[model samples]
Target: ASYSVRRVVKKSKRRYGRKLESQFQHGGSRSLWQGLRTITDYRTPSSRMVNADASLADELNARFKAADNHANGASGTNSVHAERAGEVNTFTTSEHDVRRAFKRVNTR
Candidate 1:
C-alpha cells in the first residue's frame, strides 16, 4: 500500500501539483505531518479504493463548485440581512397601513 500511494502522488504532482503537492510535502510541525500522513493513507489508492475515492471526490467537488457558482451570482450574493436592509423605503403604503390591511382581511 505504501507504493500504491507513492505512485499516485508522483503522477498527480506532475500535473496538478499546486492543489495537492503541499499536502504531501513535509510540514512545519510533527503533528501536522502526522495528520497529513493519515489523510494520505485514506486517499491512498488501491484497485478497490481508487474507484471509490474518485467517485466520492467527484461528488464532493461538484457540490463545492455548484455552491461557488451560486455565491458568485448576483442573485445569490444578496443575503437575507442585506435584502431586509433597504426594504423599509416608503412606498405607496406606510409601515402601519400594510399591517392594518392584513388585520382587516383576517377579521372578515
Candidate 2:
C-alpha cells in the first residue's frame, strides 16, 4: 500500500531577473502595472500622475468599514472592529484629500 502525497516541487532553478519600481515611485505594487490604464474612453491628460497613497488609503478604508458592520455584537472584538473601521475610513479619506491637493500643487 503506497499512499504518497504528491507535492509540487520546482526542480528547475531560474533567478527572476527584473527591475521593480516600488508603489511610491511607479505608483503600483504587486506587478500590476498593466492595471494602470485609465478607464475613461478619452485619453488621460499627459501630465496626470497617479498618487499611490490616496489610492491605497481609499481602498483600505472601505474594506475595513464593511468588515466592522458585519461583526454585529459578537463581543468586544466587534466593538473594536467598529471603532477601528471608523478610524480607518477617516484616515483614508483625509489622506486621499491631502494627496490630491499635493498633486494639484505640484502639477500646476
Candidate 3:
C-alpha cells in the first residue's frame, strides 16, 4: 500500500515538475514570479496572511535558516561541519551501481 502511494506521489511530482519547466521556458520570469507569489500567498495554519510588504525571498530564506539551525541543534552538529560532510559525501558515487540501476529501469 505504501509503495503504491509512493508511486502516485512520484508520478505527480514528475508531472508537476515538467509543467513548471515548460511554463518557465515559455513564460520566462513572469511564470516563475507568479508561482512564487502563489506559494507565499498561501494562508498559515492560524489563518494569518503573510505580510504583503515583506520580501518573500528574504522571508523564505530566514525561515529555512531557522529550520536548518533547529535541525542542527537537535542533531548536536554544527551546520558548517554538516554542510562540509555533505559536500564530501557527494563524490562517493559508484558508476557500476548507477549503471545497474539504469539497466533495471530499461528492463521495466
Model 1 misplaced regions, further than 4 Å: 1-52, 74-108
TM-scores for every predicted model: 0.21, 0.21, 0.33
**Which pairs of residues collide in candidate 2?**
none
Q: Is candidate 1 or candidate 3 better by lDDT?
A: 3
Stretches of model 2 off by over 4 angstroms after superposition: 1-51, 73-108
Per-residue lDDT of 36 in model 1: 58
Residues 21-55 of candidate 1 have per-residue lDDT tens digits of: 55556543665556656756645454765447677
Off by over 4 Å in 3: 40-108
Which is the better candidate, 2 or 3, if ranked by TM-score? 3
- Per-residue lDDT tens digits for candidate 2, residues 24-97, read 35755644443333322435477544656687788888777666656674533566655678564533458888
Model 3 per-residue lDDT at 41: 89
- Top lDDT prediction, candidate number: 3
Q: Per-candidate RMSD vs. true structure?
A: 23.7, 19.7, 16.3
Candidate 3 residues 1-108, lDDT tens each?
999999999999898778778888886778776776786685436745655555877899777877887876754545686668756454566999898888889542
Clash pairs detected, candidate 3: none
Q: Model 1: which residue pairs collide? A: none
Rank candidates by lDDT, best first. 3, 1, 2
